[model samples]
Target: MSEELGMREEPRGRLYRVTHRTVYEYDDDVTSSYGRGFLCPRDFPGQRRIDHELVVDPEPEDSSTGVDAFGNHDLYFHVTQTHRRLVVDAQSTVAVAAEQTSWANWDDWADWEDVRLRLAQEPLVRQYVIDLDPPEITDEVLRWAAPTFAARRPLVEVVAELTHRIYKELRYDPGSTTVATKVSEVLAQRSGVCQDFARLAIACLRGHGLAARYVSGYLLTNPPPGQPKLVGADATHAWAAVCFGEDRWLAFDPTNNQLVSDEYITCAWGRDYADVPPLRGVIYSEAKTSTIGVSVDVAEL
Candidate 1:
Protein backbone atom coordinates (compact mmCIF):
# COMPACT_ATOMS: atom_id res chain seq x y z
CA MET A 1 0.00 0.00 0.00
CA SER A 2 1.20 3.52 -0.75
CA GLU A 3 1.25 6.11 2.04
CA GLU A 4 0.31 9.75 1.54
CA LEU A 5 3.24 12.20 1.51
CA GLY A 6 2.96 16.02 1.90
CA MET A 7 5.39 18.96 2.02
CA ARG A 8 4.92 22.51 3.35
CA GLU A 9 7.34 25.45 3.11
CA GLU A 10 7.23 28.94 4.67
CA PRO A 11 9.53 31.91 4.20
CA ARG A 12 10.28 34.56 6.86
CA GLY A 13 12.42 37.74 6.99
CA ARG A 14 12.43 38.68 3.37
CA LEU A 15 14.93 41.18 1.97
CA TYR A 16 13.52 41.32 -1.54
CA ARG A 17 9.91 41.17 -2.74
CA VAL A 18 10.58 40.58 -6.39
CA THR A 19 7.99 38.58 -8.29
CA HIS A 20 9.17 35.07 -9.16
CA ARG A 21 8.09 32.28 -11.48
CA THR A 22 8.42 28.58 -10.74
CA VAL A 23 7.30 25.29 -12.20
CA TYR A 24 6.43 21.89 -10.75
CA GLU A 25 6.73 18.78 -12.95
CA TYR A 26 5.31 15.37 -12.13
CA ASP A 27 5.37 12.10 -13.99
CA ASP A 28 2.23 9.96 -13.95
CA ASP A 29 3.84 7.46 -16.32
CA VAL A 30 2.77 4.06 -15.08
CA THR A 31 5.20 2.16 -17.29
CA SER A 32 8.27 3.49 -15.53
CA SER A 33 9.28 1.94 -12.26
CA TYR A 34 10.16 5.38 -10.89
CA GLY A 35 8.11 8.50 -11.46
CA ARG A 36 9.79 11.89 -11.11
CA GLY A 37 8.67 15.41 -10.18
CA PHE A 38 10.60 18.69 -10.29
CA LEU A 39 10.39 22.29 -9.01
CA CYS A 40 12.32 25.21 -10.48
CA PRO A 41 13.32 28.44 -8.75
CA ARG A 42 11.01 31.45 -9.21
CA ASP A 43 13.49 34.30 -9.87
CA PHE A 44 16.46 32.19 -10.88
CA PRO A 45 16.57 33.84 -14.28
CA GLY A 46 16.89 37.35 -12.84
CA GLN A 47 19.26 36.59 -9.99
CA ARG A 48 21.89 34.51 -11.75
CA ARG A 49 24.81 36.15 -9.96
CA ILE A 50 24.54 33.83 -6.95
CA ASP A 51 25.63 30.85 -9.08
CA HIS A 52 22.72 28.95 -7.59
CA GLU A 53 21.22 25.65 -8.70
CA LEU A 54 18.64 23.56 -6.91
CA VAL A 55 18.87 19.79 -6.53
CA VAL A 56 15.83 17.70 -7.43
CA ASP A 57 15.49 13.86 -7.18
CA PRO A 58 17.06 13.64 -3.75
CA GLU A 59 15.42 10.40 -2.65
CA PRO A 60 17.33 7.12 -2.51
CA GLU A 61 17.53 5.31 -5.84
CA ASP A 62 15.13 2.48 -6.54
CA SER A 63 12.90 1.09 -9.26
CA SER A 64 9.82 3.01 -10.28
CA THR A 65 6.96 1.81 -8.07
CA GLY A 66 4.44 2.83 -10.70
CA VAL A 67 4.64 -0.51 -12.51
CA ASP A 68 4.46 -2.68 -9.43
CA ALA A 69 1.22 -4.68 -9.35
CA PHE A 70 0.71 -3.31 -5.83
CA GLY A 71 0.43 0.23 -7.23
CA ASN A 72 2.15 3.13 -5.47
CA HIS A 73 1.42 6.86 -5.42
CA ASP A 74 3.91 9.58 -4.42
CA LEU A 75 3.47 13.36 -4.06
CA TYR A 76 5.83 16.33 -3.70
CA PHE A 77 5.77 20.16 -3.46
CA HIS A 78 8.32 22.93 -3.99
CA VAL A 79 8.25 26.51 -2.65
CA THR A 80 10.35 29.47 -3.81
CA GLN A 81 10.74 33.07 -2.58
CA THR A 82 12.29 35.99 -4.47
CA HIS A 83 12.44 38.75 -1.85
CA ARG A 84 15.34 39.56 0.55
CA ARG A 85 17.17 36.89 2.56
CA LEU A 86 16.03 34.16 0.19
CA VAL A 87 14.30 31.42 2.14
CA VAL A 88 13.38 28.44 -0.05
CA ASP A 89 11.79 25.38 1.50
CA ALA A 90 10.40 22.13 0.11
CA GLN A 91 8.41 19.21 1.52
CA SER A 92 7.62 15.82 -0.03
CA THR A 93 5.06 13.40 1.29
CA VAL A 94 5.17 9.80 -0.02
CA ALA A 95 2.22 7.50 0.55
CA VAL A 96 3.98 4.15 0.17
CA ALA A 97 5.70 2.99 3.34
CA ALA A 98 8.44 0.77 1.93
CA GLU A 99 8.92 -2.16 4.27
CA GLN A 100 12.13 -2.51 6.24
CA THR A 101 13.62 -5.63 4.70
CA SER A 102 17.01 -7.16 5.31
CA TRP A 103 19.73 -6.05 2.89
CA ALA A 104 20.63 -9.71 2.48
CA ASN A 105 17.30 -10.54 0.88
CA TRP A 106 18.13 -8.35 -2.11
CA ASP A 107 21.60 -9.83 -2.51
CA ASP A 108 20.75 -13.02 -4.38
CA TRP A 109 18.05 -11.46 -6.55
CA ALA A 110 20.06 -8.42 -7.81
CA ASP A 111 22.51 -8.91 -10.68
CA TRP A 112 25.05 -6.09 -11.01
CA GLU A 113 26.53 -7.15 -14.34
CA ASP A 114 23.15 -7.31 -16.02
CA VAL A 115 22.21 -3.91 -14.66
CA ARG A 116 25.42 -2.28 -15.88
CA LEU A 117 25.04 -3.86 -19.32
CA ARG A 118 21.41 -2.82 -19.69
CA LEU A 119 21.94 0.67 -18.34
CA ALA A 120 24.58 1.17 -21.04
CA GLN A 121 21.71 1.29 -23.54
CA GLU A 122 20.03 4.29 -21.92
CA PRO A 123 21.45 7.58 -23.17
CA LEU A 124 21.03 9.72 -20.06
CA VAL A 125 21.99 7.13 -17.45
CA ARG A 126 24.75 5.82 -19.67
CA GLN A 127 26.02 9.35 -20.15
CA TYR A 128 26.09 9.72 -16.39
CA VAL A 129 28.36 6.71 -16.23
CA ILE A 130 30.52 7.86 -19.12
CA ASP A 131 30.83 11.40 -17.84
CA LEU A 132 31.64 10.28 -14.29
CA ASP A 133 34.11 7.46 -15.22
CA PRO A 134 33.40 5.66 -11.95
CA PRO A 135 36.36 3.89 -10.35
CA GLU A 136 37.87 0.77 -11.84
CA ILE A 137 37.99 -2.48 -9.89
CA THR A 138 41.69 -2.75 -9.17
CA ASP A 139 43.55 -5.01 -6.80
CA GLU A 140 44.79 -2.28 -4.42
CA VAL A 141 41.66 -0.14 -3.91
CA LEU A 142 39.53 -3.28 -3.84
CA ARG A 143 41.79 -4.89 -1.26
CA TRP A 144 41.73 -1.76 0.87
CA ALA A 145 37.99 -1.20 0.40
CA ALA A 146 37.26 -4.92 0.60
CA PRO A 147 38.13 -5.17 4.27
CA THR A 148 35.47 -2.54 4.89
CA PHE A 149 32.61 -4.99 4.29
CA ALA A 150 31.66 -8.43 5.55
CA ALA A 151 32.44 -11.57 3.53
CA ARG A 152 30.33 -13.06 0.69
CA ARG A 153 28.47 -9.84 -0.04
CA PRO A 154 26.77 -8.54 -3.16
CA LEU A 155 28.13 -5.46 -4.86
CA VAL A 156 25.37 -3.37 -3.28
CA GLU A 157 26.05 -4.94 0.07
CA VAL A 158 29.72 -4.17 -0.26
CA VAL A 159 28.90 -0.61 -1.19
CA ALA A 160 26.51 -0.24 1.74
CA GLU A 161 28.87 -1.84 4.22
CA LEU A 162 31.82 0.21 3.05
CA THR A 163 29.77 3.37 3.17
CA HIS A 164 28.76 2.65 6.74
CA ARG A 165 32.32 1.91 7.61
CA ILE A 166 33.39 5.22 6.13
CA TYR A 167 30.71 7.00 8.13
CA LYS A 168 31.72 5.31 11.35
CA GLU A 169 35.38 6.00 10.63
CA LEU A 170 34.63 9.70 10.21
CA ARG A 171 33.17 12.38 12.45
CA TYR A 172 29.90 14.35 12.00
CA ASP A 173 31.20 17.88 12.34
CA PRO A 174 29.74 20.84 10.42
CA GLY A 175 32.44 23.46 9.87
CA SER A 176 34.89 20.81 8.85
CA THR A 177 33.82 21.17 5.25
CA THR A 178 31.49 22.91 2.84
CA VAL A 179 29.30 21.49 0.11
CA ALA A 180 32.10 22.23 -2.38
CA THR A 181 34.54 20.27 -0.24
CA LYS A 182 36.41 17.50 -2.06
CA VAL A 183 36.10 13.82 -1.27
CA SER A 184 39.84 13.60 -0.74
CA GLU A 185 39.64 16.36 1.86
CA VAL A 186 36.80 14.57 3.63
CA LEU A 187 38.83 11.38 3.68
CA ALA A 188 41.81 13.21 5.14
CA GLN A 189 39.87 14.53 8.12
CA ARG A 190 37.71 11.40 8.43
CA SER A 191 34.90 13.64 9.71
CA GLY A 192 32.22 15.83 8.19
CA VAL A 193 28.48 16.36 7.82
CA CYS A 194 25.80 14.52 5.85
CA GLN A 195 26.97 16.12 2.62
CA ASP A 196 30.45 14.85 3.24
CA PHE A 197 29.19 11.37 3.84
CA ALA A 198 27.31 11.50 0.56
CA ARG A 199 30.35 12.72 -1.38
CA LEU A 200 32.50 10.04 0.15
CA ALA A 201 30.00 7.35 -0.67
CA ILE A 202 29.66 8.55 -4.24
CA ALA A 203 33.39 8.66 -4.70
CA CYS A 204 33.82 5.18 -3.27
CA LEU A 205 30.99 3.71 -5.28
CA ARG A 206 32.28 5.26 -8.45
CA GLY A 207 35.73 3.92 -7.71
CA HIS A 208 34.18 0.47 -7.47
CA GLY A 209 32.67 0.63 -10.99
CA LEU A 210 29.20 1.57 -9.76
CA ALA A 211 27.30 4.63 -10.86
CA ALA A 212 26.32 6.42 -7.66
CA ARG A 213 24.75 9.84 -7.32
CA TYR A 214 24.23 12.29 -4.46
CA VAL A 215 20.80 13.24 -3.09
CA SER A 216 19.55 16.05 -0.85
CA GLY A 217 16.21 15.91 0.96
CA TYR A 218 14.44 15.77 4.30
CA LEU A 219 14.22 12.82 6.67
CA LEU A 220 11.31 12.19 8.99
CA THR A 221 13.25 12.06 12.22
CA ASN A 222 12.06 9.72 14.93
CA PRO A 223 10.67 12.54 17.01
CA PRO A 224 9.79 11.96 20.64
CA PRO A 225 6.15 11.98 21.74
CA GLY A 226 4.88 15.34 23.10
CA GLN A 227 8.27 16.94 22.49
CA PRO A 228 8.71 19.44 19.68
CA LYS A 229 10.37 18.27 16.48
CA LEU A 230 14.08 18.89 16.31
CA VAL A 231 15.17 21.97 14.36
CA GLY A 232 18.08 20.98 12.09
CA ALA A 233 17.06 17.34 12.11
CA ASP A 234 14.13 18.09 9.83
CA ALA A 235 15.96 20.67 7.74
CA THR A 236 18.02 19.00 4.96
CA HIS A 237 19.81 15.67 4.64
CA ALA A 238 22.10 14.08 2.04
CA TRP A 239 22.57 10.45 0.95
CA ALA A 240 23.76 8.36 -2.02
CA ALA A 241 22.32 5.70 -4.35
CA VAL A 242 24.22 3.07 -6.31
CA CYS A 243 23.23 1.50 -9.59
CA PHE A 244 23.13 -2.22 -8.94
CA GLY A 245 22.15 -4.29 -12.02
CA GLU A 246 19.50 -4.23 -14.74
CA ASP A 247 18.68 -0.54 -14.36
CA ARG A 248 17.92 -1.18 -10.71
CA TRP A 249 19.38 1.12 -8.07
CA LEU A 250 19.28 0.97 -4.30
CA ALA A 251 19.38 3.80 -1.81
CA PHE A 252 21.87 3.75 1.02
CA ASP A 253 22.64 6.23 3.78
CA PRO A 254 26.18 5.91 5.05
CA THR A 255 25.67 8.69 7.55
CA ASN A 256 22.84 6.75 9.19
CA ASN A 257 24.27 3.30 8.42
CA GLN A 258 20.92 2.14 7.00
CA LEU A 259 18.84 1.93 3.86
CA VAL A 260 16.26 4.65 3.27
CA SER A 261 12.77 3.72 4.49
CA ASP A 262 9.32 5.35 4.73
CA GLU A 263 10.67 8.12 6.96
CA TYR A 264 12.81 9.42 4.07
CA ILE A 265 11.45 12.12 1.73
CA THR A 266 13.47 13.19 -1.29
CA CYS A 267 13.58 16.70 -2.77
CA ALA A 268 16.41 16.64 -5.31
CA TRP A 269 19.43 14.78 -6.65
CA GLY A 270 22.53 15.50 -8.74
CA ARG A 271 26.14 14.59 -9.47
CA ASP A 272 27.05 16.39 -6.26
CA TYR A 273 25.85 19.02 -3.78
CA ALA A 274 26.52 21.70 -6.37
CA ASP A 275 23.67 20.26 -8.39
CA VAL A 276 21.04 20.41 -5.64
CA PRO A 277 21.07 23.10 -2.94
CA PRO A 278 18.11 23.70 -0.64
CA LEU A 279 18.23 27.53 -1.02
CA ARG A 280 20.49 29.54 -3.31
CA GLY A 281 20.34 33.11 -4.72
CA VAL A 282 22.02 36.49 -4.95
CA ILE A 283 20.85 39.64 -3.10
CA TYR A 284 21.64 43.34 -3.52
CA SER A 285 22.06 43.75 0.20
CA GLU A 286 25.66 44.40 1.34
CA ALA A 287 25.51 42.39 4.59
CA LYS A 288 23.25 39.35 4.97
CA THR A 289 22.64 36.52 7.39
CA SER A 290 20.42 33.52 6.73
CA THR A 291 18.64 31.12 9.07
CA ILE A 292 16.78 27.87 8.32
CA GLY A 293 14.11 26.02 10.27
CA VAL A 294 12.27 22.74 9.61
CA SER A 295 9.66 20.49 11.26
CA VAL A 296 8.22 17.08 10.29
CA ASP A 297 5.61 14.76 11.83
CA VAL A 298 4.19 11.38 10.73
CA ALA A 299 0.94 9.73 11.77
CA GLU A 300 -0.03 6.11 11.11
CA LEU A 301 -2.68 5.52 8.48
Candidate 2:
Protein backbone atom coordinates (compact mmCIF):
# COMPACT_ATOMS: atom_id res chain seq x y z
CA MET A 1 0.00 0.00 0.00
CA SER A 2 2.91 2.39 0.70
CA GLU A 3 4.47 1.85 -2.67
CA GLU A 4 1.06 2.38 -4.18
CA LEU A 5 0.46 5.22 -1.72
CA GLY A 6 3.18 7.21 -3.51
CA MET A 7 6.19 4.94 -3.91
CA ARG A 8 7.74 6.28 -0.74
CA GLU A 9 11.60 5.98 -0.71
CA GLU A 10 18.61 3.70 2.05
CA PRO A 11 23.09 1.10 3.20
CA ARG A 12 26.14 2.40 5.00
CA GLY A 13 28.08 -0.44 6.51
CA ARG A 14 29.33 -0.37 2.92
CA LEU A 15 29.26 2.59 0.54
CA TYR A 16 26.21 2.54 -1.71
CA ARG A 17 24.80 4.26 -4.78
CA VAL A 18 21.04 4.78 -4.69
CA THR A 19 18.90 5.98 -7.57
CA HIS A 20 15.20 6.84 -7.31
CA ARG A 21 13.12 7.95 -10.27
CA THR A 22 9.48 9.04 -10.28
CA VAL A 23 7.52 9.77 -13.44
CA TYR A 24 4.06 11.31 -13.66
CA GLU A 25 1.90 11.11 -16.77
CA TYR A 26 -1.21 13.20 -17.10
CA ASP A 27 -4.17 12.58 -19.36
CA ASP A 28 -4.08 16.24 -20.48
CA ASP A 29 -1.72 19.15 -20.24
CA VAL A 30 -0.98 20.33 -16.70
CA THR A 31 -0.51 24.08 -16.38
CA SER A 32 1.35 23.96 -13.09
CA SER A 33 2.44 21.64 -10.25
CA TYR A 34 3.98 22.08 -6.83
CA GLY A 35 5.95 19.36 -5.10
CA ARG A 36 7.71 18.74 -1.81
CA GLY A 37 9.73 15.73 -0.62
CA PHE A 38 12.91 14.32 0.85
CA LEU A 39 15.23 13.65 -2.04
CA CYS A 40 18.55 13.88 -0.21
CA PRO A 41 19.43 11.31 2.43
CA ARG A 42 19.61 12.66 5.97
CA ASP A 43 22.85 13.01 7.95
CA PHE A 44 21.82 11.33 11.15
CA PRO A 45 24.00 10.19 14.00
CA GLY A 46 26.28 7.33 12.92
CA GLN A 47 25.48 8.02 9.25
CA ARG A 48 27.65 9.67 6.58
CA ARG A 49 26.40 11.69 3.59
CA ILE A 50 28.93 11.55 0.77
CA ASP A 51 27.08 13.29 -2.09
CA HIS A 52 23.57 13.79 -3.47
CA GLU A 53 21.60 15.46 -6.31
CA LEU A 54 18.02 15.93 -7.52
CA VAL A 55 16.75 16.66 -11.06
CA VAL A 56 13.32 17.84 -12.03
CA ASP A 57 12.09 17.68 -15.62
CA PRO A 58 10.37 20.61 -17.36
CA GLU A 59 12.62 22.82 -15.24
CA PRO A 60 10.63 24.20 -12.36
CA GLU A 61 10.25 27.99 -12.37
CA ASP A 62 11.05 28.08 -8.64
CA SER A 63 12.80 25.68 -6.30
CA SER A 64 14.52 25.51 -2.95
CA THR A 65 16.51 23.08 -0.82
CA GLY A 66 16.66 23.18 2.94
CA VAL A 67 16.26 21.16 6.12
CA ASP A 68 12.89 20.50 7.67
CA ALA A 69 11.95 20.70 11.35
CA PHE A 70 13.08 17.10 11.83
CA GLY A 71 16.52 18.11 10.46
CA ASN A 72 16.13 16.16 7.24
CA HIS A 73 17.05 17.65 3.85
CA ASP A 74 13.97 18.65 1.86
CA LEU A 75 13.18 19.88 -1.65
CA TYR A 76 10.41 22.15 -2.85
CA PHE A 77 9.71 22.87 -6.48
CA HIS A 78 7.09 24.42 -8.76
CA VAL A 79 6.73 23.66 -12.47
CA THR A 80 4.77 26.19 -14.48
CA GLN A 81 5.40 24.95 -18.00
CA THR A 82 2.51 23.25 -19.71
CA HIS A 83 3.31 19.57 -20.07
CA ARG A 84 1.79 16.12 -20.03
CA ARG A 85 4.67 14.37 -18.28
CA LEU A 86 6.97 15.22 -15.36
CA VAL A 87 9.99 13.45 -14.00
CA VAL A 88 11.85 13.59 -10.69
CA ASP A 89 15.21 11.91 -10.43
CA ALA A 90 17.32 11.77 -7.29
CA GLN A 91 20.66 10.05 -6.82
CA SER A 92 22.60 9.77 -3.60
CA THR A 93 25.91 8.27 -2.53
CA VAL A 94 26.22 7.51 1.15
CA ALA A 95 28.11 5.45 3.71
CA VAL A 96 25.60 3.62 5.91
CA ALA A 97 25.39 3.41 9.72
CA ALA A 98 26.15 0.13 11.50
CA GLU A 99 24.81 -0.66 14.97
CA GLN A 100 24.76 -4.01 16.69
CA THR A 101 21.55 -4.62 18.68
CA SER A 102 21.61 -7.31 21.36
CA TRP A 103 18.54 -8.79 23.02
CA ALA A 104 20.31 -9.69 26.30
CA ASN A 105 22.00 -6.37 27.03
CA TRP A 106 19.63 -4.57 29.39
CA ASP A 107 21.65 -4.24 32.55
CA ASP A 108 21.44 -0.43 32.74
CA TRP A 109 18.44 -0.01 30.46
CA ALA A 110 15.37 1.58 32.04
CA ASP A 111 12.01 -0.17 32.27
CA TRP A 112 9.36 0.46 29.63
CA GLU A 113 7.16 2.39 32.01
CA ASP A 114 10.11 4.42 33.26
CA VAL A 115 10.98 5.44 29.73
CA ARG A 116 7.40 6.50 29.10
CA LEU A 117 7.41 8.71 32.18
CA ARG A 118 10.69 10.29 31.13
CA LEU A 119 9.31 10.98 27.66
CA ALA A 120 6.30 12.81 29.03
CA GLN A 121 8.60 15.67 30.02
CA GLU A 122 10.50 15.77 26.72
CA PRO A 123 9.42 18.25 24.05
CA LEU A 124 12.04 17.45 21.40
CA VAL A 125 10.83 13.92 20.79
CA ARG A 126 7.16 14.78 21.23
CA GLN A 127 6.93 15.73 17.56
CA TYR A 128 7.77 12.22 16.45
CA VAL A 129 5.51 10.27 18.83
CA ILE A 130 2.37 12.37 18.96
CA ASP A 131 -0.65 10.50 17.51
CA LEU A 132 -3.38 13.09 17.62
CA ASP A 133 -4.14 13.16 13.92
CA PRO A 134 -5.92 10.28 12.15
CA PRO A 135 -6.43 8.76 15.61
CA GLU A 136 -3.84 5.99 15.21
CA ILE A 137 -3.84 5.16 18.88
CA THR A 138 -7.08 3.78 20.27
CA ASP A 139 -8.40 1.53 23.01
CA GLU A 140 -8.12 -1.44 20.70
CA VAL A 141 -4.54 -0.56 19.86
CA LEU A 142 -3.63 -0.36 23.52
CA ARG A 143 -5.37 -3.63 24.26
CA TRP A 144 -3.49 -5.37 21.48
CA ALA A 145 -0.17 -3.95 22.68
CA ALA A 146 -0.91 -4.72 26.34
CA PRO A 147 0.78 -8.12 26.46
CA THR A 148 4.04 -6.83 25.00
CA PHE A 149 4.41 -3.96 27.49
CA ALA A 150 4.76 -6.40 30.35
CA ALA A 151 5.39 -5.32 33.93
CA ARG A 152 8.85 -3.73 34.25
CA ARG A 153 10.08 -5.17 30.93
CA PRO A 154 12.96 -3.33 29.24
CA LEU A 155 11.81 -0.81 26.62
CA VAL A 156 13.93 -2.19 23.82
CA GLU A 157 12.82 -5.71 24.65
CA VAL A 158 9.20 -4.68 24.38
CA VAL A 159 9.86 -3.03 21.01
CA ALA A 160 11.69 -6.03 19.61
CA GLU A 161 9.05 -8.44 20.88
CA LEU A 162 6.30 -6.52 19.13
CA THR A 163 8.41 -6.37 16.00
CA HIS A 164 8.74 -10.14 15.93
CA ARG A 165 5.09 -10.68 16.74
CA ILE A 166 3.95 -8.50 13.86
CA TYR A 167 6.28 -10.21 11.43
CA LYS A 168 5.25 -13.67 12.52
CA GLU A 169 1.50 -13.14 12.73
CA LEU A 170 0.67 -10.61 10.00
CA ARG A 171 0.98 -11.42 6.32
CA TYR A 172 2.84 -9.05 3.96
CA ASP A 173 0.21 -8.69 1.31
CA PRO A 174 1.04 -5.69 -0.90
CA GLY A 175 -2.53 -4.61 -1.47
CA SER A 176 -3.95 -5.47 1.93
CA THR A 177 -4.35 -1.81 2.85
CA THR A 178 -4.01 1.73 1.52
CA VAL A 179 -2.28 4.94 2.55
CA ALA A 180 -5.41 6.01 4.38
CA THR A 181 -5.63 2.77 6.38
CA LYS A 182 -5.56 3.44 10.11
CA VAL A 183 -3.76 1.40 12.74
CA SER A 184 -7.05 0.06 14.07
CA GLU A 185 -8.02 -1.10 10.59
CA VAL A 186 -4.61 -2.69 10.12
CA LEU A 187 -4.97 -4.44 13.45
CA ALA A 188 -8.34 -5.81 12.40
CA GLN A 189 -7.12 -6.90 8.95
CA ARG A 190 -3.87 -8.48 10.22
CA SER A 191 -1.90 -7.74 7.03
CA GLY A 192 -0.39 -4.83 5.10
CA VAL A 193 2.78 -3.42 3.52
CA CYS A 194 5.77 -1.72 5.13
CA GLN A 195 4.06 1.57 5.92
CA ASP A 196 1.09 -0.15 7.53
CA PHE A 197 3.33 -2.38 9.62
CA ALA A 198 5.54 0.52 10.63
CA ARG A 199 2.53 2.64 11.57
CA LEU A 200 1.06 -0.18 13.62
CA ALA A 201 4.28 -0.59 15.57
CA ILE A 202 4.43 3.15 16.17
CA ALA A 203 0.87 3.15 17.45
CA CYS A 204 1.75 0.48 19.97
CA LEU A 205 4.66 2.48 21.34
CA ARG A 206 2.68 5.71 21.59
CA GLY A 207 -0.12 3.80 23.35
CA HIS A 208 2.39 2.95 26.06
CA GLY A 209 3.28 6.69 26.26
CA LEU A 210 6.59 6.15 24.57
CA ALA A 211 8.01 8.17 21.68
CA ALA A 212 8.33 6.29 18.38
CA ARG A 213 9.07 7.56 14.86
CA TYR A 214 8.39 6.46 11.30
CA VAL A 215 11.47 5.99 9.07
CA SER A 216 11.45 6.19 5.28
CA GLY A 217 14.31 4.80 3.21
CA TYR A 218 15.48 2.08 0.83
CA LEU A 219 16.31 -1.55 1.67
CA LEU A 220 18.44 -4.10 -0.13
CA THR A 221 16.32 -7.05 -1.25
CA ASN A 222 18.05 -10.11 -2.66
CA PRO A 223 16.97 -12.06 -5.68
CA PRO A 224 16.25 -15.80 -5.69
CA PRO A 225 19.33 -18.02 -5.50
CA GLY A 226 21.44 -18.26 -8.64
CA GLN A 227 19.53 -15.45 -10.30
CA PRO A 228 21.08 -12.19 -11.36
CA LYS A 229 20.07 -9.17 -9.32
CA LEU A 230 17.59 -7.03 -11.14
CA VAL A 231 18.32 -3.32 -11.44
CA GLY A 232 15.73 -1.09 -9.75
CA ALA A 233 14.16 -4.09 -8.02
CA ASP A 234 14.85 -2.77 -4.56
CA ALA A 235 11.94 -0.86 -2.97
CA THR A 236 11.30 2.10 -0.73
CA HIS A 237 11.37 0.75 2.85
CA ALA A 238 9.99 1.89 6.21
CA TRP A 239 10.44 1.04 9.91
CA ALA A 240 9.80 2.33 13.45
CA ALA A 241 12.24 3.77 15.95
CA VAL A 242 11.49 3.85 19.67
CA CYS A 243 12.92 6.61 21.83
CA PHE A 244 13.98 5.06 25.12
CA GLY A 245 15.08 8.40 26.57
CA GLU A 246 16.16 11.79 25.23
CA ASP A 247 19.59 10.53 24.19
CA ARG A 248 19.01 7.23 22.38
CA TRP A 249 16.66 5.50 19.95
CA LEU A 250 16.41 1.92 18.77
CA ALA A 251 14.96 1.28 15.31
CA PHE A 252 13.26 -1.95 14.28
CA ASP A 253 11.69 -3.15 11.07
CA PRO A 254 8.48 -5.04 11.76
CA THR A 255 7.99 -6.07 8.16
CA ASN A 256 11.48 -7.58 8.03
CA ASN A 257 11.42 -8.56 11.72
CA GLN A 258 14.94 -7.38 12.56
CA LEU A 259 16.95 -4.54 14.05
CA VAL A 260 17.95 -1.97 11.47
CA SER A 261 21.63 -2.24 10.50
CA ASP A 262 23.88 -1.25 7.59
CA GLU A 263 21.54 -2.77 5.02
CA TYR A 264 19.00 0.00 5.59
CA ILE A 265 19.48 3.61 4.51
CA THR A 266 17.99 6.61 6.31
CA CYS A 267 16.02 9.16 4.30
CA ALA A 268 13.58 11.11 6.45
CA TRP A 269 11.76 10.20 9.65
CA GLY A 270 8.60 11.70 11.18
CA ARG A 271 5.60 10.78 13.34
CA ASP A 272 4.16 8.82 10.43
CA TYR A 273 4.28 8.26 6.64
CA ALA A 274 2.41 11.48 5.77
CA ASP A 275 5.17 13.58 7.25
CA VAL A 276 8.05 12.29 5.14
CA PRO A 277 6.71 10.65 2.03
CA PRO A 278 9.20 10.47 -0.84
CA LEU A 279 7.10 12.62 -3.14
CA ARG A 280 3.73 14.41 -2.90
CA GLY A 281 2.38 17.18 -5.10
CA VAL A 282 -0.55 19.38 -6.09
CA ILE A 283 -1.37 20.13 -9.72
CA TYR A 284 -3.62 22.73 -11.35
CA SER A 285 -4.95 21.39 -14.54
CA GLU A 286 -7.98 19.96 -16.31
CA ALA A 287 -6.47 16.48 -16.53
CA LYS A 288 -8.92 13.88 -15.32
CA THR A 289 -6.29 11.42 -14.14
CA SER A 290 -2.61 10.75 -13.71
CA THR A 291 -0.31 7.76 -13.23
CA ILE A 292 2.91 7.58 -11.23
CA GLY A 293 5.73 5.05 -11.46
CA VAL A 294 8.77 4.81 -9.18
CA SER A 295 11.93 2.83 -9.83
CA VAL A 296 14.62 2.35 -7.19
CA ASP A 297 18.06 0.76 -7.23
CA VAL A 298 20.53 0.21 -4.38
CA ALA A 299 24.01 -0.76 -5.54
CA GLU A 300 26.89 -1.40 -3.15
CA LEU A 301 30.08 0.39 -4.01
Best by TM-score: 2
Clash counts for the predictions, in order: 27, 4
Cα-based lDDT for every prediction: 0.48, 0.81
Q: Candidate 1 regions off by >4 Å?
A: 1-93, 107-123, 130-153, 224-232, 288-301
Error of 1 at 63 (Å): 32
- lDDT of candidate 1 at residue 33, scale 0 to 100: 20
Q: What TM-score would candidate 2 get against the native?
A: 0.90
Displacement of residue 109 (Cα, Å) in model 2 is 3.0
Model 1, 102-218: lDDT tens digits are 576565434445455556666555434532423323344344464654334456657657766876788888688886666766777777888888777776655544577777655
Q: How far is candidate 2 from the true structure (C-alpha RMSD, Å)?
A: 5.7
- What ranges in model 2 sit over 4 Å off? 1-12, 105-108, 221-233
Please report the candidate that would top lDDT against the real structure: 2
